[model samples]
Target: MNVLSHADSALSLLPPVVAILLAIFTRRVLLSLGVGILLGALLLTQFSLGDTSLFLVDTVKGLVWDDGALNSWNLQILGFLVMLGMITALITVSGASRAFAEWAKNRIRNKRDAKLMTVFLGCVVFIDDYFNSLVVGSISKPITDRYYISRAKLAYLLDSTAAPICVISPVSSWGAYIIALIGGILTAHGFTESGHLSVFVQMIPMNFYAIFAMLLLLCVAIWGLDVGPMRQHELKAQKGELFDESKGLPPGANADLPEADTGKIIGLFLPILALIAATLYFMISSGADVLAADGNAFSVLGAFENTEVSQSLFYGSIVGFIVTLGLAFAQKLSMELIIKGITAGARSMLPAIYILLFAWSIAGVIGQLETGKYMASLVTGAIPFALLPAVLFILAGITAFSTGTSWGTFGIMLPIAADMAMGSDSTMMLPMLSAVLAGAVFGDHCSPISDTTILSSTGASCHHIDHVITQLPYALIVALISIVGYVVLGYTASVMAGFMACCAVFAVSVVGLKYYAR
Candidate 1:
């Protein structure tokens, strides 16, 4: 029955939750993760209070020193930090971020344009969602704040806009990953075509939750529907008090450097170009699009699947960062000056990395327990045929929200969705799988505990809980509309219909709420 794994892993996350609560309440993300990790280890080991001396050693070894433990993901995450350091350094040394911000301010006259700019900025930095959060948060916080937007609201806008924007974008890190996963599904489904083109075309139209969530956020940004924590933010803005920043900048960051750097323009563009090139190359090398049902991974350059793309994009981002940093050094930028900018980026990410590490560890434990598979199996066994798609979407959404990871949730649910699809008509299967993935993202966007959500807050220098409180109401409102969209899509087996309905419903909801709530 795997009872020990289930008992230990399934419940191990509880202590971590308490730790996060303590961290938020105490204003310490790192300390929270440390305490949480220790507590999680204790739960896994069933250590008594008196046995802590030995338990401490073992837990440290297992968590930080073990081959697949914290240290490893720490290393992987370090690569990202280094990359972030280089890129942000490049931006500062050259002046691109400021220039972009200035251009945005000069042109963007309203909230809709601001939100659209955020989306466009997110699209422009697609190698990593983590990077996107930092750039967007650093740049947008000031702009949004000037317009009387709350830090929490800004954080929500940044967080919700980061990953999903990449996921849907044709040329981002997420694009490659989704492509890889879909490719495998396509092959298994006996498709004559390859590289996920078939599934991507079918599923993109059915990603209702993604479509509606963005629409709702954009609507709120423009028309202004203040409810839940948003209303509180509005009231605070009226009083001229906003976020609790440690400095004139966001909390826990340095603004000693001048706000404008003349050289930063070239610095910013270099690393971004490198990051993109590296990503495309990395995807090609992975087992992605190389094979055309004939056993090779590269029948064409454009054929790789999603996981392959994900791995490459992660690695590519690092490679791009190094080259970009080297360019700055070549241009006679002082090493000290460049290093300072790098440190700024890394310091900002410290909280996010801690949360990601714990989230990864939790994912490891849950994976050991096969939690998603079990849940999927349970749902599959209990539900009737007609209700499968809707039920699966709901289940996937809940799990992602609880765990604070849409990708992990999808990794689990995708296979189940594929299995269900393989058993049914291909027409019925593709859109349904997309719906589950979309819903998982919806839930992850709203989850207070999600790392992406947390990073977005950290990036925007907003109070974490404040971000959660404000964002949840908006996410839920969109999700409520999405439910109807998905059900109709499921029944009619029409991806286009579901997606358009989603847009229409969200538009109506945003207008009604803004008008009536007053």
Candidate 2:
């Protein structure tokens, strides 16, 4: 807190680089994040141990307790994580997951069907990445496991689809946040020809990364296109080693959980359906209430823009938890067993919660160090007109990868992207903005510290490192294709041309991958 005058200098790059590299090589997420946090605090405090200590303490304290009050947003999200864990445990212990798997096995033929089902669910639950990541994994896992699909593959399916779908869908939390930002940028730059929502819709075809990533994931699921580390995981899974036991089980996975043979499929479907309904209701109601307070009409888009997503998820989880408990009582599970299951389930989430806490802490320190600002500053110069979109895509990817938050990257880079486009080529504004969106999602997909990535791993009950490593190759493939797409869009100034280029590249990549895989 004492300060570094050159906070936005190259020195700001140290923490994230060190953290990310250490996480990849050592596969120790907590230690890597802790080191990053410590380094950032020291740098921010100019290496004063006392100041660094205070900064570290205050950083974490601020997450849960800010300004002498509980921080509603962060606390609510944490509550949701815990409640989700408890519900998951109850479902497993009561054998609801097993029951559902048994019920589905008759209709679903093989791994391809299971994988496709996962993709379908991932697409359907596009409201929030956090929700999509966890719920889809839980629903798909039992089915996937039945077909000898690796948890890492299930995680890949979850991670690859969640952000891309949310980023593209207008009704999603990510879309709302982004549209609001685009609105501000448009207003500031005096672009009144089109509304923010319209611009966002137009940019959908231009979001090359999001569009292509989903396409590639579907191909992978249908064709069994396993590559790199993912192939190793899949092979091991086929040999009856679903995951390396030595690396430890993922969050919310307890091998000791009891499986009741009498568990009914209704027990599984009811609680999950209830959770989704409750979450949707709360989300709409919360957003509507905010709109009404501000004397605005009740519009779905307006409601989403004002909705408190964390609050809604937390409330929905509470309803889900109650439903789960009622189902357990109806199943006649013993009181002691139920209590034990709840404790175990909550305890399973402790690891994820701890990692998230540290991740958030380091993100705060990174912000104070102006890491994103430093990254953004490097692109503030004369750039080639035809390369601006592709360049912004790369820059945004790097910034989001380093900062571990796509939203943060959007806040820091979107305005810069807008100004650059306006000054250089006003016609390229939409494509440029779309590149930033694509790049942010690309970076978020690769970052080990990203919350969506972590939740994806937790949801699939796979080792966090396995999820990161397995998905990295797939992410890189789509990102490269997206870069090509952006470059084409920049040169041709046609969204269709860019999308076609992406499709051609993707088709070739898939064919090449299939041959290589064989």
Residue 400 lDDT in model 2? 94
Off by over 4 Å in 2: 5-7
Error of 2 at 509 (Å): 0.6
Model 2 over residues 1-518: C-alpha lDDT tens digits?
57664455898989999999999999999999999999988888888999888888899899999999999988998899899998888898898999999899899989999999999999999999999998888788889999999999999999988999999888989999999999999999998779889989988989999988999999999999998999999999998878778887777576778877768888888888889999988999999999999999998988888899999999999999999999999999988878887988899988888888988888888888889889999887777789989999999999999989999999999999999988988889889999999999999999988888889988888888889999998899999999989889888988899889999999999999999777
Residues 111-190 of candidate 1 have per-residue lDDT tens digits of 56665666667656654566577656655654565556677777777777776676676455566567767677667768
Q: Where is model 1 more than 4 Å wrong at Cα?
A: 1-3, 7-43, 46-74, 82-105, 109-112, 138-148, 169-171, 189-195, 234-242, 246-252, 258-345, 381-384, 421-427, 500-504, 516-518
Top TM-score hit: 2
Against the unseen true structure, what C-alpha lDDT does each candidate score?
Answer: 0.64, 0.90
CA displacement after TM-score superposition, residue 485 of candidate 2 (Å): 1.0
Candidate 1 lowest-lDDT run of ten:
1-10
